[model samples]
Target: MAQVLEFKLPDLGEGLTEAEIVRWLVNVGDVVAVDQPVVEVETAKAMVDVPCPYAGVVTARFGEEGSELPVGAPLITVAVGADASGGSSEGSGNVLVGYGTSEAPARRRRVRQAQPAARNGRAEPREVPAAPAAPETPAAPEPARPSDGPVPVISPLVRRLARENGLDLRELTGSGPDGLILRADVEYALRAAAAQHRTAAPAPAPVARPVVGGETRTPLKGVRGAVADKLSRSRSEIPDATCWVDADATELMRARTAMNAAGGPKISLLALLARICTAALARFPELNSTVDQEAREVVRFGHVHLGFAAQTERGLVVPVVRDAHARDAESLTAEFARLTESARTGTLTPAELTGGTFTLNNYGVFGVDGSTPIINHPEAAMLGVGRIIPKPWVHEGELAVRQVVQLSLTFDHRVCDGGTAGGFLRYVADCVEQPAVLLRTL
Candidate 1:
């Protein structure tokens, strides 16, 4: 007797409420094996191809491409070994794994320990012990610490940058909402400090603190809207922070130029930087993880899907290069070209935009020296590469011009602290500064 099976939408790691159907790799009546790619779903992160949980014949596709599916909603039906309601017919009927489970009540029994009787007949009401007295209140408030003076609250990315550059956050003014410190503020302060160090004198701390305006509103739609939602959710739900470092992009640029000159497809400087970031994420798997609040778990993936922010006519789209950590520079360059073309033409499928383990955004393309970007929700961190410019540098008692780039890494603080974020950014810089580092690992 042939049986029927129902497949529902699975939890795609980011706790997303709904997902858009990108495409169907398999059609009705097609026999599929367990773990076979059946369909692709697009979440906010990237498009993910879901595999079949059991070998069966596809009976039907419930939804059409481009339709949104709520979690646990059935997407397909199949005929397996037994009837569709084979295993356990509890809440909402049974579906495959990744697809949410049916709601079912479980009965569990617990045994309570017996309590000893009080010595006195005060066994009355179990003779509860008297509560401890409250502590006395202080006469005055405690003094504030030196570090607490006028410190501007900025994004996690700024805080991480400040810490790495040995910046005193209290001395910097904010440019964000309500006097919040901004990534630019931290960068300016760091540059000022670096200049002071070169002059053999410490500059007086900045006293003029800037206050952010009270009523500022930005419409949340398209790319900016998506970025706002992701960043806000990351800051509120994920304990996140940021770190910054300077990368000597002189050699990386040379490599890029050379690669391009030799009949290689022209790739963006950002692509080279992304390749380095992808390599580093492979070495440090923690950076490629997501925090599961409901399960209270940190999930680390074996593969890397490096998501890069692409500004298109539609909005800001992050097209991912799947299995990025395993690919070479040439492969990445080609893939990036394909992704960019698709994004520009608005031909990218929903699946092309989901499933990122880490992200990279090149503010450098805009000639920005340095700025903190918000962390992508669920992903632990995002690496922002600034424009590489030829700046005067002190090299062994001589001042010379060299190409340098700033790297801003914003991470979820709930998972890693300043120190960890710093280490990860530094690792990424090292890989970019010395591409040979990846050669050995790869």
Candidate 2:
């Protein structure tokens, strides 16, 4: 006999609580392998392919596409025995953080007393003793009473919605398969209650307002929402200051041209700027640190995890290059290229989007001159590079048309004073004006 093992949505890491279903890769009757990606979901940070840990024939799916499901909610149920398919099913070692299956998942199971929050959407999480697993039976279209059985709730988010509005779960019947109460049912119930209340009391007069058309309102969710929240938090929390300078980038441009002309692999200007930033960070380690508000301590990082801003159709995302200080210019170029392509394709993982010690914002690609970049939260500084355009400047007491660029440094005031910030900027400018200076650190 096939035991229907329910696979809850495994927790996608990086503090993400919920994800909207973007697409389902498998149907109800489709056969899934262990660790095979079964669904694609969009969290606040990035789009993730959620893989199922159990290998079996998928019997049921929980949520529809385009709907948001909280972490730990039932994602799918797989019949995991020889009868499920020609071959028996087992657990995969490769599983996400929150949930996983042990060996012999088909015969025995651990009843995870997952608080409704993750599965149901509850505050406290506790573990219960393992029990002999049983096959899930099709439930009738009725609410289960308190003494009868567990509440027929599909998502913890629905439970929370009904809870916040003071709706009783046992009073209303479930509408989903297996008597699963869905968000729509709770919302409809709340709306009906609100209408009855309004009927009992006189409603307020409708406020008149001019209707405006041709305005598109896009919901701030996913990457855009994440960016907005982080930027807002940065602005509200960090005491930031911006310092800028114009530098002759002719030498830096020439050096890059020379390196590419004689190179096995072409180097990128962003990579060169990143190299300079790492050097400057080494000179001023305070700029490569984060301020811990609670500890009231400034945490300095030993190595650089360089984050660069890449604008994609999804919005602005900063893809990180880990251990950037250890990477050469050629390696940085390749990593940056790979990450940028991932960002464009919306395939950059959450890990690729976080843990940045210092950010290099090359807004030059947009044909802009300079910008006081908002520091990515938790990180203490950002180095902005502008377009290198031809400008007439004094070259050894003589006016000449040279490739000039504007560099701006935005630093957290709590981390360091203006002297340190200025010194760091000056070092970077000096490197652009004189590429030979970078060789000292190299």
Q: Name the best candidate (by TM-score).
A: 2
The local distance difference test score of each candidate is 0.66, 0.81
TM-score of 2: 0.75
TM-score of 1: 0.52
After superposing candidate 1, which stretches have Cα over 4 Å from the reference?
Answer: 1-225
Candidate 2 lDDT, 1-442, residue by residue in tens: 5566777777777877888886677766677777877886778777666788777667667776667888878777776665444455666757553334444443554333333343322223344553333444322225534634346776444554676577877778888997788878898999998888789986663234234553446788777889999999999999999999999999999999999999599999999999999998999999999999999999999999999999986789999999999999999999999998888767787788889999999999999999999999999999999999999999999999999999999999999999999999999999999999999999
Tens digits of per-residue lDDT for model 1, 153-217? 54333453565466767776687888788777777777776787769866664444334553445
Q: Lowest summed-lDDT stretch of 10 residues in model 2?
A: 114-123
